[model samples]
Target: MRFIFLVLLALSIALGLGGWSAHWALDQSAEIGTVTIGPWVANPSAGAPDADPYSKARLAKIGNLTLGLGEGVQFTADRDAAGRPLRRECQYRLAGQTPAARVWTIAPYSQEGRLIQPGSGRVAWLTSNNLMRAEDNSFAIAVGPRARAGNWLATAGTGPLVLSLSLYDTPVSAASGVANVELPELTLESCPDA
Candidate 1:
């Protein structure tokens, strides 16, 4: 009886410590939501340096909790090289090694937390929506003013873009995992001239 009681006490202490550590690490990582771009870097009414203005369910993970945001990264737009409302064509690729949930989505958002001027151009790619799918059942999306046709992610004529790849329904394993996850990089192709 005494041996069992001691083991239980040790397990409780270990769990408590692990949870506390997770919160601390999260607080230290840079805020992924709020990132801004553009010339002058001052125009949006909300504020300069646009922060993460998108509405998304929190991210989840499992295992070591290591996430991969592709090495190639692209930032939001404020102005073009010529300083005339920058525009660009780009693609985003997302993948997960062991996600807790089976479904996921990549949605766009503005600084004010609203979907940009609605259009079929590119709204939300959801598993249930039955749109995005790769050969292996993974997913990818393209973002631009014009439509890429399939897997297109639409953008407003002028404003910052917040792309959120949300993992549906947080998984219990991820909650206990101690690793990071990865996100796709935004590949910029064509930016409007100055």
Candidate 2:
């Protein structure tokens, strides 16, 4: 009877630990196959055929259509330069030059992965072709609930927000790992609530 009880206790401990570990792995926001550059994080291998089990599970759970290895890489930022969580009530500026790419897009989305629609007649996303660049080719985009003078990306409602920067037909995708690429910096401009 003593030996049987000991075996049962060991089995229970093993099962409990196993279940906890599996849950922790699946719940991680930044999985193993990911690269972080500044405030942006990208899992280049998430869409590859040989992606790890965790990467595949994360993609499946999020229901995101990831860019293929040869297509491009999509970087996501949920925080500002100071590492504060991005909130819709605050204003921000995305300023910098992107890595080499045939085309790139910057858009705002809710934490649930849905696009955040702005007021009618206003653009909620910006593309590389239509932006006004500085003399040196750098660009600045204003993001907030209110409208700005130039290169504006508007958001609506109040909640946590995310920024998605998708680079298409870029050399970054062809590389095995992320190179020293410069991505835009998201700086908090203002917040009425704060």
Candidate 3:
């Protein structure tokens, strides 16, 4: 009887642990084939055929199409360079030199993966063609509630902010086995409550 009870208890514990692990694997923090640069993270195999089960599950749960290996790569940032959570009430300056890509785009989205609506007549995204370059060939984009003159990503939503940078037709995907690519710098400028 003692032997049987111990076996049952161990089985129950194993099952519980398995269930919990599955749940956690589907959470927001769950990612496979990911690379981190500062506050940004890139899942180069997000849309690849060899994607792990967690990445496949995440992509299916989000219901969004990811770029394929030859298509491009996407990097997401949920915090600033100072390691502070990005908030809609705060302004940020995203500046840096991007890697070699035919075209790129930066956009702000809510935590739910929905694109934040831009202000009246203003865009919520910046494309490679419309970006302004500094003397050193670095670019900057403003992000906040208020509209700015240069490239801007309007944070008109009411939730935590997330920035997505997409590089189209770039040689940075996982298939190429290239890592440590140059990304942008996300600096917190100011905040209304600050």
In order of appearance, the predictions have TM-scores of 0.44, 0.86, 0.84
Candidate 3 deviant stretches above 4 angstroms? 1-21, 175-178
For model 2 the TM-score comes to: 0.86
> Judged by lDDT, which candidate is best?
2
Kindly list the per-residue Cα lDDT of model 3 for residues 14-51, writing each as its tens digit. 99999888778688557557888888888987788888
Rank all candidate structures by their TM-score, best first, as comma-separated numbers: 2, 3, 1
Cα deviation in Å at residue 31, candidate 3? 3.3
Model 2 regions lying over 4 Å from their true place: 1-23, 174-176
lDDT of 2 by residue, 11-115 (tens): 999999998887688877455877888789988888899988888877786787889999999999999999999998899999999999999999999987889
Q: Taking the tens digit of each residue's C-alpha lDDT, what string does model 1 give over 73-169? A: 2223333334433233333332323244455555555644354554554454334356556676555555666666566666656646555444444
Best by TM-score: 2
The lDDT of each candidate is 0.42, 0.89, 0.85
Model 1 spans > 4 angstroms off: 1-100, 120-129, 172-174
Between candidates 1 and 3, the one scoring higher on TM-score is 3
Question: For model 3, what is the C-alpha lDDT against the true structure?
Answer: 0.85
